[model samples]
Target: MKHLTETDLRAWLAVIADPLATPATLLAWLEGPLKKFFPYQAVILGYGELTVGQVKTTHVLASGHDQVFLDYLPTAYETADRSSIKWWRTSRQPFFIDPENPPAYASAFEIDEIQRFGLGNVVAHGVLNIKANAGCYFSFSGVEGPLSDWHLEALKLMTPLLNDLLLAHFYLKSERSPLELDALTAQQRSIVRHLAAGMDDKTIGRTLNIAEKTVRNQLGKIYAQLGVHKRSKLIALLK
Candidate 1:
């Protein structure tokens, strides 16, 4: 596994931090930035399963007729793995599902529905907690090999980038009009993102490198301001 150079890492950070870049642009950025790190067809699955979002872009490094497959099985793509997707929701961790752990229809999944979709060997990373409120599965298939340590490391490196880019996107979107989200602090926004990701007080605290009590207090203030009583309600208000 080749380690990413400091200069390259810095370049990636700067790219993701750029304000003018949209998620579609960032998807393009990912294809270029991590080309050598993995071998698979990539798609940025937005809030829905299989129904590619507006952000679909592929690195030519990947070899697959992904677009053709998508066109042929559009309906199956949208609903085949909807329930399975929630696994990423609560764990908030990247999961690589293989033939060894293939989907079972008994588990509320439409197994035949997916195999007909013509995808193979899934590799996916979860994007936890963002404003505009959606969970993204950065996935790739059509590869031959167990995902390597380098692949996992690359995905891990991208997770926080995805978070911050989405943060910038939403903050800008919210502050664009008569409403001013500029008044909200960065910490407050971080709190909102984690809470929206379905994280509880303890997980949010650990992720933010703060105390659990601090997380609770932050949520208390956020709820009061948003006029919400539950986490779901708070997330709904924010979205």
Candidate 2:
């Protein structure tokens, strides 16, 4: 068993728990003080509010991850009916995952997330609020070593501080207009209307007389501009 230095823990907590810390400073903190003990190439933080049949992100941030990874995450696990996906539920314990051999009994959605992200070695942890049926999830990928009790312990120790920091970040606005929706070109708006109407990419392309791939690509831009991660959510936002 690798031993953890108390000094490492103390400094990590001190940096993350700083009152001055904000979303803008999170990447530096993660790559700085936190890396002293926990090393990773990318980290994703998501706060979700669960409903009867689905879990939706209320806020999300990805540091050192790609734009495609961020834009596709919300719908990666989505089902036709949006049924309950086990991975969406919280796990109080940390997960030590290696793509060569993943954690046991990992849900399909969880596995899909790993595969979709092209994640390397990962240690994931989260804190759940039972009453509200919401939680904060942390996924630290591109880890370089085997899973250890030390990594789990470090993440568990930092869970509360991380949760609070997530709450402090820019929340997914359920009621507000996204960053640049009003500025969308007419072509973009047409794509959005077709998407929101439940039309598939091929169908939308035929209607708009564009390539199917172009339709998909334009929808991606609409999602980013509207600040929505899921198609259903985007439709609701536009309504």
Please provide TM-scores, in order, for all candidate models, with all chains considered together. Answer: 0.44, 0.61
Expressed as tens digits, the lDDT of each residue in 1-239 for candidate 1 is 55567765676567556553464355455555444334565554433222243222211122344566555533233322454555555556565555545643212343443355655566567664344434444666655465445555666776666655544544554342323334446887798888877888899899999999998888777666665687777666555
* Candidate no. 1 TM-score: 0.44
- Pairs in clash, predicted candidate 2: none
lDDT of 1: 0.55
Model 1 lDDT at residue 227: 57
Overlapping backbone residue pairs in candidate 2 total: 0
- Candidate 2 whole-model C-alpha lDDT, 0 to 1: 0.72
lDDT by residue (tens digit), candidate 2, 1-239: 66558886677768766654565466566667776657888998887776665667866777888888877766323333321234434344677767678666465565666777788877778888889977787889888777778787888887787777666554423345544766788899888878768888899999999999998888888778777887787877754
Query: Which regions of candidate 1 are displaced past 4 Å?
Result: 1-24, 47-83, 100-114, 130-133, 166-239
For all candidates, the clash counts are 0, 0
Evaluated at residue 114, the lDDT of candidate 1 is 39
RMSD each, Å: 13.7, 9.8
**What is each predicted model's overall lDDT from 0 to 1?**
0.55, 0.72
